[model samples]
Target chain A: MAGIFKVKAKAKDGVTKVKMLAKHVMETGQRKDKKTGEIIPAKFIQEITVQHAGNTVFSGQLGTAMSKNPYFSFTFTGGAKGEELSISWTENTGASATETAKIK
Target chain B: MTMHRRTVVKAMLACGALVGLGAVIPGAAFAARNKDAFSSDDQAKAMQALFDAEPANSQDIVLKAPSIAENGAVVPVTVSTEMTGVESISIFVADNPTPLVAEFMIPAGTKASVATRIRMGKTSTITAVVKADGKLFSTARETKVTIGGCGG
Candidate 1:
């Protein structure tokens, strides 16, 4: 299955910048559907891990306070052009997905 | 079989504690939410629970956010620091329903910088705490929210 994340990486000045956008509703279990008026269950990315060359460079723990379709940007050292940067995320419902982006 | 039943109960309790501990262990892969900190209304208590050590004010840390947020639902926040050996970065909203917002772990090779959008229930001070070399440093800035996030 195609994961919900669109990621980009670019190498510059000994640092590789990574930007990611994930599609998610990020329901905090507080909002109600307009038609049904029923509470939406919390569904947000709980954890994210970013790896390059089999080593984790960055990881994050997130909560419901994040906005819908979260956007994350960070930079790390030691990445070269065409190198693979793998990103993975696990949601509150125990669903997880991983995708890789080549450094530009 | 009585002993077996007791052992099963004991094992279940142990598993529960492990799950709870996983959440608070910063670098653990199977991280669970810091429920107490994220659910806390008091900023001080949330900070204490999230980072056991108090963070000293630091000039090395750079926190960027809007002076006034047009929409509290998605306020852009970016934090960066030149501190070496940065282990993690955490963001907190002083007046949110749950003060603790997000925490990021920066392994050795990663730069001590991150950007994300956080929800604010109202106008409040936003704090970015950086952990480096087993010490905590922080910077805070006030951002006015015109409309409340987190469902107000």
Candidate 2:
């Protein structure tokens, strides 16, 4: 599903800090079937990557164990004011999303 | 022959009683277990590989979370670390379906601070893993959610 993502980047003292929020269900699929009493299958975002100035600085593999609407904040070096950063992810079913922001 | 028939009937009645009891007991127990859920072994192992161990307590790390969350859908969490040479920061909800919530790699020569909102299916311990200069440091806090967020 197409979800909402927000990215904010701020630069100070030659460093850039980025904060991102992505909306998702992040279902673990272990929930019980209320009527039949069986476990549901797991589904969640499997991979996430953040790129700054064409270099991969951060990456992670998330499982169904993560809570819904995952949010992340981190900092990186060497980004001048107004540099563009790209954040992207691929869900378990191969669905993908990307959000970009400029250093402020 | 009559004794044999009596024995068979008694055994059948006992089996029926056992099945009925099993159905009722497990339902109640499952409900109780659902109230507090954590990741399975494999899931925990997967998270462990991605997460570096953080010792139970540290003075340099500050974990900010509500003492009690009225709603599980959105619980604000903030982790700020003062340790020098910090490399990364990560957050994990111990009792959520997925224990690995988010991992962040802090580039060299950058400040170590992260703040965000996360969902909590139920009451859980939130852990912060901080990687600094090739080593790991950590802290945690237990957050109680009155209403479940993920519909557990």
* Reference-based TM-score, model 2: 0.68
What are the runs in model 1 whose C-alpha is more than 4 Å off? B1-33
User: lDDT tens string, model 2, A32-96?
Assistant: 77898877666677678878877876665454545577777667677888888887888766689
TM-scores across all candidates?
A: 0.84, 0.68
lDDT of 2 at B8: 100
Give the clashing pairs for model 1.
Answer: none
Task: Summarize candidate 1's per-residue lDDT along B1-152 as a digit string, tens digits.
Answer: 99999999999999999977765564344335566666567778877877776899999999999999989899999999988989999999998877788899999888899999988889999999999999999999999999988772
Give fnat for candidates 1, 2 and onward, in order. 0.74, 0.44
In candidate 2 chain A, what residue range of length 10 has the lowest lDDT sum? A58-67
- Compared with the true structure, what per-residue lDDT tens digits does model 2 show for residues B23-133? 556446744221111233333453455542434457679999998999887788888888888776767787776666666566555457777677788898888878877
